[model samples]
Target: MDAHHPWNMIPLPDHTDLNLAEIDVFTIDGIFSTPRLDNESELGYSDHHENDLSTPVPSPVPTDTSTTKETWAETTMAPPPLNRRPKARTLRNEDWAPVKDRVLELRKDKRKRLREVKEMILTEFGFEATERQYKWKIDQWNAGKNVRRNEMKAIVRKGQIRTVAEPDKRSLTFELRGEVVPKEKIDRFMKREQVPFDAIYSPSSGAETPADGILDCWTPATRFSVGRTPTPSLSGEALATNEHSFFVHNISSSPALSSITTLATSRPFEGRSPRLLHSPLAVPSSLEPNDVRLRRQLSNLEQSFGEGSEPTLGTLLELCNFLLVHGRYSSAETTARKQLAACRSLYGDGHERTGMTLSMLGQVLMLQGHYEDALGVYQKAGVILKQTSGPKSEPYLRNRIEEGVLFRCLTRDEEALEILRRAEATAQQVFGRTHDVATYAQLRLILPLVELGQFLEVEERAKELKLFYSTVTPTSQSRRIIWDVNHSLGCVLLRTGRLKEAEEIFKSIWRDAVEISGPEHPASLSYLHNIAETLMLCGRFEEAFGKTDTCISSRISVLGLNHPDTQASMRLKDRILARQRMVSRVSHGDIVQSGDVM
Candidate 1:
């Protein structure tokens, strides 16, 4: 079955026409009112009047019997009188402009009757209008205004624009939250908007060529062992100088980009990892602390790196990784951009290296909640990789996964589901269903389906994953996959209001994850949170509160107080407490009423 076609489109309720009551007066007493009967004298008077009216009434004029009979037949067979009133002119967009203000005023006041409004419209504007047309116009005006208002508010909140103006006079001078927007970023924006690039900068200044010296060293490489660093195969035969090798070798020594398997194998569906395609680690606290040793190492690298040197790219990548893993996404984004610029300078836009750096920058943008920008970057990276590394390559698949994630974040659930479904098929065909790439795609596919309220499909996919893992060796990775599947299924159950089943699943998953990975692990915390929610829904308020407190404390310790998970736990606790108070008040009121009745 096509996953894309599985989504159920929930139709909105049919709209009923507005029915206005004709009578102004209504009373319950009218139904119970007694009926009065006429007395005997009044009945006798009515009989006397009936007797006096026995005389026959006569016609005013005589008529021919045959002609009258013919006329009667003609009258009986004649077609109904034609509706002689001319049809009203069809309404147009420009025609509506004249009455727009009147429609808006009447709608805002909402006190005038539709009949009165219609009459007023005909009298004042010389146009016959119906109540339905008036209502539709009002709705259209409000919807357009609301859309613009929401869009402006979003732009303002993101600090993308300083102020919102009228639609006729929208301002284009962007006021970025920080320093100037990069040239690449602006170029991308311009291209999307279909603005002429020549209007901003000349082709000479906008386009940069890849260094010819860099591409001469391209060579096929073998996969390395799991524990060993994966080195680029820049063979001695292909290299013109030792400097390139030194730069490449130095880059490999820095913190290995926690491989894709680190994401697929270990990180559960929690924290930023759930949103990311290949997050290095689940939480920031686990990243290496920035101490004197790290500072000295960076200082030494900076001292050795010269302007326009290839080694600078390695340094930039290091800085970007450190910043990103440590939750400094804004700084990481800047550094990633710098690294991308350097990569482009060396390897050009279409090179695999440039595509990788671009994908990294997109992830950083995602971390910072710039989903629109991140989506654009992900698309660019995907295109570059598909052109240079083939569509079946791992990088391209990863790009699709990240794009799906971004689409999900942006609340474009159907789009996310479609992209993920396509990617999953590709992964299954290219890498096999059991491979980590396919598994990752399968996992990501569940998220958007859940958002779309397609719980059955979610459950089916989840069950398939569980069944697949059941046959495999119970490695830590396999266990994690099973754990994630159960967690997601439990979430679907919770959302579908199967409180008891969901609670049981959450308890079992939480217990097992805690035993395996400890309470501080993101997976355990997530399951614990799920338990709290299920408990609350089941009316086990006290237990829910206690569990939530524990989850929040653990999240604070493991992730940080400002982490979204910790804040969400705190909010859930507040809601649970509020519900408890409300239930208590209602119970007390019921008891008081019972006592009074007794």
Candidate 2:
């Protein structure tokens, strides 16, 4: 990582023997410079062998600050001197000569294929477009010279060589418009070029394409493969492995890099395409937007693994999309388990990414209702978490809250309450009682109380929560927690014979929260259902029938007919019928209100 090492400006290979057709390419800042290829190694070149890409990548130097970069192959072909411009003298840094020399030493391969290998590497790194069938496009790629870039490089701007962004290098446009490469066609090509394990020259893989047959490919991540145009996962990295040869150059690595996740290609079915872990719907409450900046930071982490980054953005993107779709699940019991295992292996068990992936996967498990599975994932999370903040960390408390929730669901009330009480106390001490953190902990604790059937505790917590909600401006998640708490309190009131009070709270909340959170929300419906039961409990037959009717309609629309909510509605209707019969015996003619369901 020397500051003055020879840098790779173009993403193409430094060897000279690779075939242009088999490799793919794109512009490096739209300025092309011819690259010098290293001399051939004495060793015989092997085709189709899996390059132990696990070979250690040399630590990269600061990319933006360096000079004396390797020019692309296009730079070697000079056009007729414009107006016989004065002969230019090239500038190469004295300090960087050693780094360049070292790279040359490392790339000791057979000279016979040096040009072809270098060309293939460049193609893999996105130094040119996918070589076309037409002859004209190939000519333009070979001529990487431009009058404008040469002029730009002359002006020393803040001690850094200025590179212009390539407006014409709009790769995704051709891709997105469907006017360019197709997946099936590419897959066919990849299949044809797929070399045997013994023949692979670089750490790259080979896809057998019908047209080319056993083509060399340096895929970014395990699940996603792009011919050229640096994928997001591997976008930031300048250095790449083309089979056995390791070429260190410069490219943008991820800004939020906690550590890199390795391609877990070590499955029993190693030759097959690697599969990603599946995700569930209903993301965990933990990753909610409590901190927008942190959310964006993590999003950048996702983006860093996205289309333009190194590795393949597709693999990471798929993971995020899956997590977003599947509510938090029991990672241990599902695909998340594989995800955690793979991430830890790549980044090492103690890395920060290990924590992020673990938390997310654990949350996924939690949402899946596999309480034991969730508890296990959280415990695993705790192991890595302890390294950073010890056992008494905010993160640890958050994980504990999840464990407590699962415990409550499992009917281990005493244990659940104990864990949450300690968590609540810790969170309040660390983040303060008035903070959203404390409120979040409180809400999690309250949910357990509801499952434990502790009405008295629910009432006390509800009063504390109502005051908390009233005083603080809530976030979307905080509001949800408040609404859920309100619904729980209303249910406790109904169950404990405080029907009138419960009715008032439920109706008021429905009127206010319906549009804000939507009418069919699970919390909204629970409160509404409680109101119907409360009316029935009060023996207001006419009013009770009206509430029951609304409950039935809402349940049918919001939750399908056979759902538990719908069944509850049916039970309420039966209760209404019984109350009507009892009231009929007392009064021959009772004046029923128009709005009354009866």
Candidate 3:
């Protein structure tokens, strides 16, 4: 049931009329993948086969009351029919010259943001700096960065430097702080890398005396004692009110043992801890409502809340992760912060999950336009995360992505470029180049390039992004990228008068979305709308109207006329209808709404 599969053109329900009252909307799993809530993805499930290009192609929607154009005609001179099989640019590097300065400016802005983040981290961790440090750092780096080719030649003659390689030329390469020299690695790692603690100390390397308490840094590990957050004994717990039982479950982390041993002799609690009194109710913070199994799980979770049995830390973390994904953006922020605070109290400052929750909270804040807050959170996440996962773990990677995007929003291109470029490089090193994660990072770089209108670079970056979906791998990640990025690139092509190419890209995505996510999915609808608009721009009248008509039918049937998606579909339909009226005077058998526009 891949909505974007070209062969799976979902049939719209047989609604004889466009009236809202008559339309019956029902939830159908797999109708379309929920478009990734992030703007980069269209409404479709991930597993949909978006790049099954061999599937039946679809025609572009027309804007006017006229004929439709063959789908994807830009790649080949001969156009393919919407239902027929069909198959499908280059600007020079200097052609990007016009946008170069702006690109540099943006890149610079990005750097400033990163600089801010580093400073924030330094401050948070007590890494102090003076104004003089800023000048010294930048001046020293820029001097090396701006060295001229001629100057290099002179230096080469002096045998002062070795030949540089292209890949490493612009990047910083160094040994892994080989030695933790105090001067080199200091407490002020916010400014310069530093070891977190001073020399370690421990008590006598033997067992503790009866008079002495168990805690001793000298011991390789901490010993466990009889203390534990007690759970209610279920035998009589039913007699206790929910409030009292709930308190027990909530505070059950402090472990106590009747029969206990240190790390060497571990045992389960005297009895099964406690039954879950409830399950979480809030949905994932960033996921869309139709995100398949995840949403269904959330629904099940809702009923369990205030009722179910207790869950372990891992289970709780997983639930929190889900909520961090689907909850309302603002709510996500608050919950993430609270969760992180709780985790910090439970696990201490150095735990990875604590930083992860904080980073997730930062993502929510950044999305909500809270830049300064995001910067602070990212800094904290980055530093704490690096300790265990190094710089390449998922938590660190995601935080970097967030940082890159945040910089872009702030109009700091250099920092965005610097961080994103590093991110991409790191991602490639961590995940293979063609991996879903790596490609997405590549697109992060491309997004800025597109804004700078460096089509050449955009094309280069886009090629990598597209390659993931264009070929057979077609992972959920690739499919998502293709659906969204292509739609985005089409917008650019449309503006650049690469009309033929633009038309092809739009039509293909529209058809693909229909097949993979189904016609009613938001992404499919958006693509359908785009196709129609492109057709209208190309003066294809009847086809545009037909596609618009089709889109409306699908939207009404799949999304229920009252849904937000259905509403947006109607607006797009209206735009197409208006264009149709302008282009062709004939009142092609009117499909009238109940006195509603279009």
Candidate 4:
């Protein structure tokens, strides 16, 4: 069943008259032995062969050359045709370097109008971009920017240094303060950290209760009934006691828990837990889409907006976002469509909100892999946005970008190129050539160009982006772009039969991807897969096996065992193992030549 097997090329021998005496057999020295078939029936031959085996048997000769030739032709099968599947496009680290800096600058304010930004991108950098592309870039930049901000704030706040937790109980012990801390504030922090702190109290009796029932010098954690010993009275200079001294030191003790404050300051108990290093989505195969938190949110929203009550625009949008984030695609799509219908009724078909609803519906559809449906939705949204808002608006441009993406997905390269070209030109005219939108448009154009076999254009754009990205201050986003540009060039080199150069490029990309995204990141896993493929091409099977194995494990962990890429990784591993077995067989003289997997 393994078509990749070399034995598939050799046809099955005719069982009708297989001569046992003339069979040439060889054993692999100290390695493996082919078991002998004691019973002729095992080989599907008649019992007559066993009875005549005691007598000396002569090799049969062909009486007629033509008949012998025909027999040989029938017995020997042709090798299976070589696989000619078009290689799947590798993930390219495309950079829109032309507009990166300006785009980043304009994207800082979340409230900026898309059209205004798009125009800026067009005018500033001569880069063409649609709003959707802008949104994507914004998301990428925001992800990195937000992480940096959190890290900086965590460093600045110095909260972890001020707080300490009890190992057995979730309470922290602290000295009495001259001023009382707000109970509501401490309660909120405790609730977020999932700590069971009911209230803050002073163990020492002589200590002032602090009218608001708040403890002085408290960092967040307070004493609880769940722990070891009762606190001694704060009377008679108890501040110098071991308990007070120990509490202060313990509050500032842990360096490991600093990330907790950063995570808590942001949205706590959302996406990835603070205890985990990566998001649940990034964890690969361990996600439970129907977790309790998601279900509670869904149920709460549904009940709050009863069947008789029409959901508001905000409520519907919230539901849609929540569902989408949770990977409930079908529900998200339904919610989006409902929102769209509501928009048509409330705002009319020509309204800007209606166009936005259509765009939301299209996004849900696209997520569900309904590309054709999404394309149609995007087109409708585009028309509405253009008519109601204007072609220069963000909504209209976002839809335009989506259309180009859909075309590419459908393998309509010419159409994709045409649409992307227009988008790029618009960005350039409005924002200028150096805008991120224009750069992104250029990047999008490369996809179709690669598909169209325009390697020269691909190389030119990739090299340009790579060089431009290198000039900028290095950030995760910039490095990612550089990696993508290099990836494109590597793909070109591979296509051109420059194995050594391609291997080096892949190696560097893999190393960088791992550094930027971590080894378990989907992108890093993909780069590792490329390195394995390159190694295999170079006949370094041993190294290839190691890389492939790691890739398979990472894919299975992050993407799940049933993911297409994971399965492909498994298949690649199989091929490497098979090749290794073939080599081993040949080395031990079990087979005369390579790929003789009889």
Which candidate wins on lDDT? 1
lDDT at position 184, candidate 4: 56
Writing each residue's lDDT as its tens digit, candidate 1 over 85-145 gives 5565677755664454334333322245767767755653455666667666654543111
Best TM-score among the predictions, by candidate number: 1
- Angstrom error of the Cα, residue 131, model 1: value is 80
For model 4, how does the per-residue alpha-carbon lDDT over 1-598 read when each residue is reduced to its tens digit? Answer: 5558865543443346655775534432222223233433433343445444343222222223333434644432322223365553332213353344334434433455778877754543344656666666655433222322222222212223333333343333322211223445445544654544432322223322222211324324432212222222221112211111111111112343211111101100011100112333322233533222333343454457642134456666776775554344434544565565556555556678877877877776564445665676777677678878888665676678768877887889899989988888888788877777777777777778877889999988987887777777887567767777787778787778788999899889888766545676656777788788888877799899999998887665544465556777999988888877877777778545444764
Off by more than 4 A, model 3: 1-342, 367-373, 392-394, 430-432, 469-475, 507-598
Each model's backbone clash number: 0, 103, 75, 32
lDDT of each: 0.57, 0.45, 0.47, 0.54
> Model 1 reaches what TM-score against the true structure?
0.44
- Taking the tens digit of each residue's C-alpha lDDT, what string does model 2 give over 508-591? 877666655445543456666777777777787777788778767765553435445567778878978988787886564444
Model 3: residue 489 alpha-carbon error in angstroms: 3.3
Residue runs of model 2 more than 4 Å from their true location after superposition: 1-356, 368-376, 383-388, 447-460, 539-598
Tens digit of per-residue lDDT, candidate 3, span 79-115: 3333433321232332322222112222222234435
Better of 1 and 2 by lDDT: 1
